[model samples]
Target: MSDAPGPDQAGPQTQLPDPPRPPLPPTAPERGGPRARLLGIAGLVLTVLFLPAGLVLSIAALVTGVRSRKRARRVLAPAPGAVAGIVLAVISLVLALSQITLYAIAWDDLNGYVTCRESALTIDDKKTCQDEYLPRIEHRFHLPKGSLRQDPSWP
Candidate 1:
């Protein structure tokens, strides 16, 4: 036989290169800090819980939420509660403004009731004043008779 293998003889097989793998998906960047998260949480809390100072608190919440979102963007982080805080703050502001408007509209009527209640010395007299005032308030607001009740809760 010759030194080279014949066509029937098997020689060493050539190795093929590996098929290219698909690239791995890129990962999300790490968040920078907790300042934005804290601000957003605080703003959301203030907007929801402290409703007595409605207009002022709502404005404050709005400001903080805006700041939180801005800071988060600057830090390349996500703003978690900032959007909720802003939305609630706007809703609170609208309710607060509507309350103020209604109060202004009912000022004289409310004042008369207040003066009557304050001047009355006896429980019977206060009850009488309330009885007279309730109907008027109900009528003005187009509510059912006895629908609105006021309790001074004084001793």
Candidate 2:
């Protein structure tokens, strides 16, 4: 055989370069803190448990999560996982809070003085009750006489 190899005899070229790998995206949620994510989950859990107070926390968590996501997108590649987590948490929180708020309002409308009475029923009840009760429990804490009005439906 000749010194030069035949086509069939030639092996595949060893010099071929490897195909480049695509770069992976970076991960960073906007606002650079865990606060939004943490608050979101905590708010959701609390909302499920404590209701009224949780509702406030849920609102806070939703607002913060939204702000954080918007901010994170502006600064770097958005962390989709974190965003999703935040969204789920926030939604859970809002739903929880809304449910509780609705229940409270319904309770108020259906049982005019029950909330007030419950507030004043026992010394132990007073300690555990909400501040909203402050206005009803004590004679000194009265709404302005003209403040009473027809119950307004929520929009």
Per-model TM-score, in order, reads: 0.56, 0.42
Q: Per-residue lDDT of 1-155 in model 2, one digit per residue for the tens?
A: 66777877875567878999998644445442356667667777777788766667666666666666776768764544456546756687658857866566556443544554455767655444433443343323355532333224310
Q: What's the TM for model 2?
A: 0.42
> Can you write out model 1's per-residue Cα lDDT over 1-111, one digit (the tens) per residue?
667878998888899999999986332212212333344344445535664555565676677677767777776766666676677777777766666777788887788
TM-score leader: 1
CA-lDDT, candidates in order: 0.66, 0.58
CA RMSD, predictions in order: 10.1, 10.2
